[model samples]
Target: MAQPTTSILCTDLGFEWPDGRPVLSGFHLAVGPGRTGLVGLNGAGKSTLLRLIAGELTPASGAVRIAGELAYLPQDLTVASDQRVDETLGIRAKREALHAIESGDVDERHFAALGDDWDVEERARATLDRLGLTGLHLDRTTGELSGGQAVLLHLAALLLRRPDVLLLDEPTNNLDAQARARLYDAVAAFPGVLLLVSHDRELLERVDQIADLRDGEVTWYGGNFSAYRAALAAEQESAERLVRNAEADVKRQKRDLVEATQRLAKSAAYGKARSVRRNDPKALADKLQGKGEETAGRLRGMHTERLNEAKERLAVAEEAVRDDAEIRIDLPRTAVPAGRSVLQLERVRLAYGGVVDLELRGPERVALIGRNGSGKTTLLRTVAGELAPAEGMITTPVPMRYLPQRLDVLDDEATVFRNVKAYAPAATDNDVRARLARFLFRGARADQQAGTLSGGERFRATLAALLLADPPPQLLLLDEPTNNLDLASVRQLTQALAGYRGTLVVASHDYPFLREIGITRWLEWDGGELHAVDPR
Candidate 1:
């Protein structure tokens, strides 16, 4: 293999939000050719850095240098309903110019538009096919495609541009298994500088290198996600060991300081008694006493300084160890008896034509798995009473709550505390704050407006509102809950779900996340039918 060429560079970059919240400062990065995975905790400025590199946001200082053309694919991709497939691929104009010139129209503008790109259509089709989009037509409207298809289409557009540097933020967020596989193949084969920010472990595993961003700094790890994890584990173990040693040193320093004080006290007393028993001159005895006191004071000061130094070292050692917090709470009100049926779907036909006959008894946890257009979301909404079934009877005897993928349950203008309070009107203010603290929104964080929160913070606030409802939901419905969450936030969510004793029906494409949440049952939605399956 040959050495890769540098394509993207950042020097002394700085950025801050309008609210005076600093995100990145003096950040420097040099990205070369090959796929690089960017991983970080939520609110760690991963997206912000990408936007800076893509020229989507202006840095407060320094500069971003790109050796060639750059293209960026964001997490939330939105195309107009009327946009045609060819238009989205950026070949509509070129195709029209090529046709006109072939038909003997001598126009300079047409020649200029078609310049050296006569095979644009063929390349577009090939790219589409490569991404498993062979069924889509050039003139098909974007509105006809599924959410996962839209994401793939956006990536196809970026590929069509053939930029030297490519930036992708959560590219596999809404994709199903097949689409995700197609995307992975594309990333593996791309011949340019690729920097992607993602929490998808599978996707991260495909990268050539890993960049772990935290505290406004980037640490490079050789090889893929697994390699990064191994390296990080080793680093953390070393840090923990250093912390332990530093703590022991501090304790020893304190003990030495106390022993020095005791020795000095004994020496001073012995000298004073000897001087008094020997009947020395009063002036001489006073001088001797003064000299002993000064010596003891100097010794005490030296010992105290050593102890302080040891404590500072301990503090620095502790700072090197990462301590990501987990969500832990009790939900006694949501518990259900083992034999009680919380939900029943009797030969039900959803509005989208999916058929299901199921019973959720006790506090069973169900994982709904399927492709993007396979009616998983439709079925979840129908079960949550957000959508009515076309046929059959569905019953939910207990209180339920639905957390949609969009997370639109809370008012954006209101504070997080206010949103939780609205959901549980009967709960006291102290009680609501106490509950929000468990979700990692304490103090002024709970007072921040919902619109101002980061993606993970917003999800936490929405979850807090749902879980803190007045009557307490016994059947919690979550749709693609891990879509935009970072790895830390995903772990936190898994921890939170583990404590919930209510029935859970989570529709997600994240297999690791689903498994981590301790799913008791698995159901696959395919061709409008629900079938039980073993956990993957």
Candidate 2:
């Protein structure tokens, strides 16, 4: 199929915060129909660029043009109540425009504008039902749904609009495998344009083009993430070589300039000596003029250093992304006893009004997984000694610290320094500062307000404190630990977990993260039972 004309075009686009910090500048891009995936690091102004394309914000410079009717779905959408699923779908008006059919009256110009195919309500209902919502859902309040359910509800509205272009940001977030498959189908079924932003490797594989945003510029690659990765690897190698060449050029230029400077100095001294000996005013002045021009010409060649400066600036620009260039982990170590079991629960039954058997041991890194309200978190808390099993005996290893799903462990009002201090009060001012520095929170960063930290930063600060304290915990229990972490920090934390020598148990929904850190086993949570299962 042929691609459509660019639906959105940004030429010389630039944006900066009100405080004069640059977010994106010289960002030029054009996106058309079919699938275009926007890839960027966390702070690369991706959302800002999306907002520009959506016309939600004006660019500081350059032009942004959008064509045709457009529909956009942000990462999270507010679900308005009092509207049923049927009321939200466009399929019901198969023979007429949804607005006209639903209103029972339409202006002639508007009707003509809509053209044919108005009575498509059956088609609309099928789309809704396919998404696991029913015809009765049209009358149900959308607010009374789970996160994934709410996402599906908004998607139905988007499909019904039959938009000329569609924009989705993190569309797969909070979705299960089944829901994600349905979303993929919806994207495939879209008849017009599709632009999406996602970190999902599997999702990006299906896109026709990928655009990576970095250093206030957009670099378009011809293929998916895998191709982009390959291309990036090649580009980094080239950049490194360029830097080496630039350094060599700079050094050579500096040497030549120093030599010329010395020659000019010697010439001036020689001329002085000759002028004193010749005693001829006219000849001495002539010699001075000739030497002056020669020295100036030599200095002019020194512009090579200026060119070298430009290359230096470019090198810094190229290396700005170096930190994101690789994936690495640094797992921390905590001692583990040779004892039979670090933690175990017998006949462990838990629920609002019930009981079930559960048991786990040391040397096992288990992932407790279930859909929402399945009580995966509750079971973790039970083992943490926070919540007791209603009708069973439970065993737990001491010195265990739990990182809750929400960062309740952090003190919001305190400075990051103060917060870290709270965890390890014994550390002196210098010792605490040194520990904070190890986690990349040195100097001013350690002094940053805890409330001001991003979700990822808060997790990092908490983890760093927990691990670097006076004595590390022997048992580690974490709940959805990777939820808000950026890819880089997530890799770092995963690396740390891999090296830790302790009884580990983690309850997470991040499959990739779990695999990276080497989860030893698994526990399936259903009803009120925590059953051990194979990791595979």
Candidate 3:
């Protein structure tokens, strides 16, 4: 039974390029009224499929139909460099109002809807505040917002639209845990069809169902991403077992055929001996001849059929396996020597725009975990020597490097190789160039402008440069290093950090990632006095 006021459906869906090459082929999906996480590798056309479903782009083949308005939130939600947060929110409100007026029943001389005329301006301001975009001048142009703020503003606008479907690509990316939690709450409460693409394991684990795009089509599993992963692992194991069995069957058949052929040969010899002397072997000779011929035929027929079966079985078994595009990362390292003091903070205090008491410190990788407005960034700034600890004594080594939550240290105009040379001036082009390759920025990509790189690529580029530094910064500070990174890159970084002999301080929400890097020391900030606790 199908219950549907409005549901999306696709059958034998497909799309291809102008050259008759397929981007998606024979795709099929049935999206009900729930959140579905789109899981696939980088180039799996997940975003393209979302666009097709939203009617933002038409499929070249087959059908993509939705009955109501849809909202699309792309991964790269950067506004034009000059758009102000308030102005953008206003535009969104006005658009929604116009859409409502156009579609509402009162368009042709009918009474207007009973609701009050929505305040686009006030509501726009309210929307920004709700998304932590308060205090920014509405009239200020878009160019002024920080990269993270810009992303947040776009998200606020998208949410205000209240469309019937949401196609979000990496919505939680680059946001801290609090922001991510807020995003999750919004998605959970949203009463519409949602299809989003993300590599965040935690984010995907909460979706209603998972839609896996593999081999040119979508496969729907009626559970969260974790369940789907478990099922996939089981399937992979089963496929391997089937392959082994099929191989063994072929070997057994070969042995049986050899035995049969030897029996036939022996029977032929007996027949010849009986026939040659004509020594009272009359019926025996005739019987042996007839039996040998029959046996030979049977053996030939059985061997042929068995061989064919084995080949077919092997093919079927092989097709069940998936390609090995597993995520991988390798962090470049120039090690740091251990010292008695990695970092020191005393009776620290912090506040946003005058708020203050967020003391922090660590001689090792220290984690700062708390809700938003809890001063995580404030604490990081204080440690980075960027902010003056208003009420406490903070001491840090003069030569430590800070990788801010946002990559503010790198120049967007410079290529990765150049960036490294600037940070590590003593290094040669060849040395820096080779270092970039280990981080996946090879050759011309190493020469690509930083401004043109993706969020993940930028993270890699910044970290690569840090590694090339002359002293490699005996102390390291990372703010959400895993955010926006694909799983492979994360693994690479994890492996690199596992062996590094440096002091680390991190402000992140990823508990697992924190645990992996060996956070031997931790400080929890509660209304601003650092409480020491063993993170082990």
Best-fitting candidate, scored by TM-score: 1
Off by over 4 Å in 1: 1-6, 96-112
lDDT of 1 at 474: 93
Can you give the lDDT of residue 390 in candidate 1? 91
Model 3 earns a TM-score of 0.64
Tens-digit lDDT track of model 1 for 237-291: 9999999999999999999999999999999999989998999999999999999
Best by lDDT: 1
Runs in model 3 lying further than 4 Å from the true structure = 1-30, 51-66, 79-82, 91-116, 121-152, 200-206, 226-237, 254-308, 318-333, 340-363, 368-478, 485-493, 499-505, 523-536
Error of 3 at 265 (Å): 7.5
lDDT of 3 by residue, 1-536 (tens): 95455567777777764444356777888787888998765446776677677676667778877757777777656567766555576563453454566687455322233145445557667767776667766667876454456666777777777777778887775566566766776777778888878877777877899988877777778788789989888999999999898888878877777887788788778778867877646687678678778878987788878877887898899888765332233433434444456566655555343333332233367777655445666667777779776666667653578888668688987777888889888878888877777777777778877765656677778887775577766678787787656565577677656645567777776778889888877766654556676644
Per-residue alpha-carbon lDDT of candidate 2 for residues 1-536, written as tens digits (9 for 90 to 100): 97457488889988875545577677788887788888776557766677778887788999888777888887536656766555555333333455764687766754664566454556566777777656434545654454566677778778777788888877765565566777887776777778888766777887888888877787899887799889888888877877777677667667766777778778777776777787768766787868776776767566556657856865774574365532232434466754536776777776443355544455567777665445666777777777867777876655677887666788878878898898888889898888777676778879877765655677778877777655667678888776545466677677667656677787765788877877777777764666777656
CA-only RMSD, every prediction: 2.6, 6.8, 8.1
TM-score of 2: 0.70
Q: How many clashes would you count in candidate 2? A: 30
